[model samples]
Target: MTAVSTEIPQRRELVTELPGPRSRELAERRSAAVAAGVGSVMPVYVARAGGGIVEDVDGNRLIDLGSGIAVTSVGSAAPRVVEGVRQQVGESTHTCFMVTPYEGYVDVCEKLAEVTPGDHAKKSALFNSGAEAVENAVKIARYATGRQAVVAVDHAYHGRTNLTMALTAKAMPYKKGFGPFASDVYRVPTSYPFRDPEGMTGEQAAQRAILAADKAIGADQIAAVIIEPIQGEGGFIVPAPGFLSALAAWCKDNGIVFIADEVQSGFCRTGAWFASDHEDVVPDLVTTAKGIAGGLPLAAVTGRAELMDAVHGGGLGGTYGGNPVACAAALGAIETMEAEDLAGRAREIETIIGDRLRELQATNPAIGDVRGRGAMMAVEVVKPGTKEPDAELTAAAAKRCHEQGVIALTCGTYGNVLRLLPPLVISDDLLREGLDVLADALSPKG
Candidate 1:
């Protein structure tokens, strides 16, 4: 197969209505064949995606601000990723990493250790999704520390699997009806600056959470304290300054493994290799996915060698855990990140998008908060005069943006956050245009 063009025009152009006839037909077919549980942010069917635009089957090109929920950070069909996938497909797709390993898998693991935070000697185990990585990280923590209790924080989102559902805090879509979740999982308060009492410092908030965990689940019994340094689905919540470090310190002092779920915040998404680097905090185990393979199915748990090796041989191996093709794609993705300095690009995105969103907040009282790091940013919508979440307004704004040839996503526990995860490779012009579309969507008339 030929490589996808990286030169696809970097502008949004509507050739037809959103979800035009072709997309409508595809939607009908999808409804019939696909499971009802599967959800989509938009009904438009993508025909080609590259750079900052997702071209639908109806020939309408929409500026992508979601980046497939923070995947494709190097842009959909990044040239290097395409090349790597193509080469790997021609050679071998799978040999079962457990049965017969390839150099690609090891190479990806080595890259993970190098990119993830901390200077300690690290080892890695590959998986197929963020949820799998998280589950494995928890398993490693339990095995290494010989503790059964796990602590997840409020407004957290880990994944949808049984164990992850127990860890995830939200219930509506992610956890509802998913019953009999894994045992010994506990929830604690997190340092949510926006919702926390005014003037409460990060240290205080951290102490509050620590006390809750200690009181509820004794420190000796806790295997791990997992968190998203910047919560993803719970809103692009960047915890108060000292929150993460304090938590890491507490975990260290108490023999609880600190696992940072960087699935959405790692790989230069937060202008760094990992969000933990922002505070100079080091996690004992870090779960990474989303941007890891540049749109391929790949995930990993990278951590201290001693902890990782605690799992005996044959304890952690899946049929397709480290598929050779996906591993190759990850190698290419890492190469692109390094060659293009995408971390620096993410910082640039922060400066550009952050300034614009703050300006919008100044004029729009409904925008209760503007927070996030680097390319991962969001605006929490609320009532005009109060902090009451406005999920209706958030949904309406998202609908308007979708209709106007811009892809925007809504998140947050209350469903009131308009998140923007634009591809780091997006051009300055496209970024501003997408933001303009968002502003228009949130306008009074809209």
Candidate 2:
């Protein structure tokens, strides 16, 4: 198989309209065949993607700012990932790790142990998606601690499964109709500096959450405290300094397993191997996905060997978990990250995007806040002179970006935050152009 090229021209060029003719046709077909439950942010139908551009069927090349929701951090069609998957496909697709294991799977686990935030001997179990990895983390925590209750924070989004829905705080689309969620899940306050009481330090916020958890579900009864180091779907909310470390210390004192949901923030997406590394906070368990396997589906839960090995031999794993192809892709992706120094690249991205957004915030009252680390930056939109969310304005800005051939995504519990997750491989020129589009989109119109 020929290697997928990473040499696509690093520029955005729109021909015809936004959706164009071919994409519109595909949209019609999708409306009929695809389930209505699945949603899409842009109308364009992609034909090929590389570096920073996603080419559509109608021959329009759009600048990719969303990175497929932070999944393609190593860049779409990364050379190493393409080569690895090509070779793996020729050899074998699946023997089912549960049935007949492969070296690729073992190699991925070893890599996970090395990169995850901790020096302790660690082991890992692979899964198919972020939600699956999170679910398995909770299982391991509960089993090891002999406890039942799990604690989640406000605005947190774990996943879509019944159990994860219970963990997620959003109710509209993710949890509204889906009732009767998994039991033993509790919610607490999180340190959102933008909305917190004026001058509330991270330690104070941690204490408030601790008090709430203690009052609601005694710490001794809690199995695990799972959180996204820098929440992904929850508007890229980065907690105040010292918040995570305080929580980790509290969990240690309480015998509760601390799981960092780095599904979105891992694999150098946040200027570091893991966001937890920024604060020197080591979680008992770390769940990873998104950028783990390039564009392929692969997730993992890596943690202390003792905690991971607590379960029975066959207790962990799924039929397609750690499929050889995905494992190969992960190895290749990790290799690319290390060889390319994507972590440093992410920090550079943070400098570029963060400076631009902060400048925008200075003049635009609608931009309530500019926050997040590395390439996972966001702008929270709000009514001028007030903290109240402005979902309408957020939607309008995102729509404008789409019409201008830029892919942007919106998130947050209130749906009023515009998030940017560009691939680490994106060119400086493309990044600036995409930012220019966003700036124009957010600008007030007559």
Candidate 3:
């Protein structure tokens, strides 16, 4: 047996079947204990994971393309992260960063300030989930700008809280029964190039959204305008080139705090530290969580110091906002990102996946569009020669890929978009293998 350390295991092994019998029994028990609303794409229970691979309880080893929904960018069981967590846990688990501050928490904040995009003086506040980070960004914006109304893009996925749910555009499961959402939240059109009128430029789409915001809410009353550089659950939708910068300029001119919800696209998932880098549109505030801590639960809102400090003392934070162990994990994750050049790796994956996806689009007439930035990408499914969504076929393709041992996710308002967010550290060969599986799954017969 290999000695455990803060490093990747030297070997990849799968000894049991996928979701071995034991895992199935445990899953049944879990289903009984939890609400049915919480879903699982693959029922295989994880026994252990290292690098870009996850070993199921049943002994089947599978490449992890999901990265725990983009949370484990450095790869599962990263050595530094594991070591840091071990040390932190051995010292102390929780004191609530608010009650008694610790070095790990402070260190994370320091790192966030130094690394987050803008050259301006920045500050950061930690949270446990992307939703909390987003909610806190809104709170800070409202507090800073002294405005009540907030604007968000169509098909944005903010969070589950009342205010965030209001910011979010999807209704089916997120907003379905959760009635009485927060008010003063308005939705504006996003620069969805695939669906835009032919010949429309990115600037045109931004103007359309700005016009809607101006007329509907009056840019003056809007405290903040939040958008994901690349819409995540809304289907890895990458906006046009000039769209984000135009919107950012508008927000700046109107004194509205611009927020980039990089929850799913940050931490080098899209070839850069943040997807915002793709457009060089620095926002007043940036929310991040998914890949920040190498699978440990950690999220943050980094922004201009003045705005972040606008909140009164004790106005922000949580019991487990910046847990010491999580902070340690974040430190390790950041180090791995810088040292191993995972950002470059993400770009490489993009080239490989992009080329393959374009080829698939050419072969599969049902694929209406293939779009995304860096490793964060998607293929939109539609009826051949028409825009009608083919969610059924999308679901089937995902199921087939799963049967072939590849885990992929489907998104989009109509659930017709297949998104790819494999860990940045995923080997090119493994990634290509997964894409081959996807291609076969998409074929007329598999």
| lDDT tens digits by residue: candidate 1, 1-446 | 11124867777999887789999999999989999999998999999999889999999999999999999999899988999999999999898988888999999989988888888999999999999999999999999999999999999999999999999999999989879899999999998899999999889999999999999989999999999999999999999999999999999999999999999999999999999999999999999999999999999999999999999998886999989999988998899989888999999999998999899899999999999999999999999999999999999999999999999999999999999998888888888999998998998887
Per-candidate RMSD, Å = 2.1, 2.2, 2.6
Alpha carbon lDDT of each predicted model: 0.93, 0.94, 0.87
Residue 31 of model 2: what lDDT?
97
For candidate 3, report its TM-score. Answer: 0.96
Candidate 3's error at 1, in angstroms?
Answer: 26
Q: Candidate 2: worst 10 consecutive residues by lDDT?
A: 1-10
Clashes of 2: 0
> Residue-wise lDDT of candidate 2 within 339-435, one digit each (tens)?
8899999999999999999999998889999999989999999999999999999999999999988999999999999999999988888899999
Decoy 2 TM-score against native? 0.98
Per lDDT, the best of the predicted structures is 2
